[model samples]
Target: DTVSYGRIFKADKQTRIASVGIGYADGVPRALSNRLIVKINNKKYHQIGRICMDQLMIEINDENPIAIGDEVILIDPNESKDLTLEDWAKLTNTITDEIICQFTTRLKRIEI
Candidate 1:
């Protein structure tokens, strides 16, 4: 879910961020740390800092006003219009198939 980063000491800046409940433990490659981007409400936002065991934070700008349960697009699988699994493959210097297969049992799949 979304969080305001470092509220105790860094409250002045009020950097909005979303900490997704998926990370290296969920088959997310560690190489994607600080390099991945996710889409929220069709707008792009870069991931910030290192991706942890079970979460990754995306920087949300001031105007976006993201909520706790807003949809987050991790990999679209269609590179023509948005970030895709292949994109992540490139970032990790691996193949798309590996990228697709790397996701662990920790994730839940929903069929459309």
Candidate 2:
């Protein structure tokens, strides 16, 4: 155990909702644990359930919203739709650098 934590993500942009593939066993520190606040269509939604080793769950109840393959912001420069890394830092008393680096290189990043 590398002493990492997990976060439930329900990020979005306008109406494109996304549930991130992230969780505890992925080196997500338990300290940074909670229902993550994702700004979608200028609103926040709750990430439901306890985080798993590979992925957590989120609610995507938008009307005529995005599909399974639609693009959603997980970690992007667009702060308007998703929570800032600074927010994560504040929440866990960590830093932005640490938070972003949490993911191992083996993880594939699909930015849309």
* Each prediction's number of clashing residue pairs: 0, 6
Q: Least accurate stretch of 10 residues (summed lDDT) in model 1?
A: 2-11
lDDT of 2 by residue, 1-112 (tens): 1111333333344333345666665655445445466444445665554556776555667664545654444444567433777766777789889987787765666798
TM-scores for all candidates? 0.80, 0.59
Sliding window of 10 residues with minimal summed lDDT for model 2? 1-10
Q: What does candidate 1's lDDT look like per residue over 1-112, in tens digits? A: 2332332213246676667888888888878766788888878888776677888877776586678888888888654543887788788889989987888888888999
Please list the residue runs of candidate 1 whose C-alpha ends up more than 4 Å from where it truly belongs after superposition: 1-14, 79-82
Q: Number of the top candidate by TM-score?
A: 1
Best-fitting candidate, scored by lDDT? 1
Q: Cα lDDT for residue 27, model 1?
A: 86
Q: How much does candidate 2 score in TM-score?
A: 0.59
